[model samples]
Target: MKLRELALISSGINERRNPQGTIYYIGASDFVAPSLLNKLIKPSIMPSEKLEKHFLTKQDVIVLGKGHNGFVGHTIVDDSKPMVASSSFMVLRDFHVKVLPKYIAWYINLESTQQELRSYSRGTALPSINRTILGDLEIKIPPLKIQKQIIEIDELKKQESKLTTQLDQLKTIQLELLLKNKIKNYEQ
Candidate 1:
């Protein structure tokens, strides 16, 4: 099914900053990966009432709409505070019952899917995927049970990668300590 058929695709808000604003703004730089976002620090204040409609929820999936590197991120905002993505992102919400938001984000973040998305980008300097192109992109929907399993496996892979990095660092430190001890004994 096409993405538009599964969820409502809309451009993020294009508003100026307001000092007295209350909404948190998420920009392309905020993403650490296609599925992760950095902790919110300072919030962008937009002095517009229309921003209420753009407020992000946990179920919303944000896609980098304008750039050479296109990626998608699942929204991780605190529900206590209102938040909205910047104009550089396209928000997908109101997903169909047959699909899960995280599953959609995971599928899009795949290397193969990312390559396909890049192919649809336009412009030379700052290639971008317009709303129509993004909406028309195909999405493969699996059974809910399978979708849950995929998400769980993907999470485990991420955890494994992180743990492996830590282990490598520890091994390096251990080797360095051993070398230092050997040098000290030889000097003695």
Candidate 2:
């Protein structure tokens, strides 16, 4: 089924230079997976009226629009609250129950899917996927139970990746210490 049938694809807030009433803003680069908004980027205030429609929730998926082809399909699962995406992102929300948000996010971030997105993108300098392009994309929905299992497995893989990185850092530090001690011994 088309992505629009599963979720609403909408443009994000167009930030105003100046306006009345304050609302939080989130640009495409402000988020990192597994990290909440507070640490990645600070929220800036825009006019509430300007932001009324772009408010996001934990379920929202924010995809980068205008960027290098490598980043065109880059996306973030919006686990953060009380914020809105800037014009650089296409916000997806109000997902249908037949699909899990994480599952769809995983599918779209897949290398194959990203390649397809790049093909559909437009621009001479900074390629971007507009709502129409995003809306037409298709997704296969598995049983909800299967989707849950997939999500669990995906989370485990992400955890394992993080642990592996930590272990590599420790190994590097250990090697550095051993080399430093050996050099000192040689000098002595």
The model with the greatest TM-score is 1
List the candidate 1 regions with Cα displacement exceeding 4 Å.
Answer: 18-21, 180-188
**Model 2: residues with Cα > 4 Å off, grouped in runs:** 16-22, 34-40, 69-81
Whole-structure CA lDDT of model 1:
0.82
Q: What digit string (tens of lDDT, one per residue) describes model 2 on residues 1-188? A: 99999998888777654344245677656655532354645456755564666677776777777777343333344444467778888888888989877788777877888888889889878788889888888887889999889878978998999899999999999999999999999999
What is the TM-score of candidate 2?
0.87
Give the range where candidate 2 is weakest over 10 consecutive residues by summed lDDT: 69-78
lDDT per residue, candidate 1, 21-55, as tens digits?
66778788877755566765457685466778888
Poorest stretch of ten by lDDT in candidate 1: 71-80
Evaluated against the true structure, the overall lDDT of model 2 is: 0.73
The total of clashing pairs for model 1 equals 0
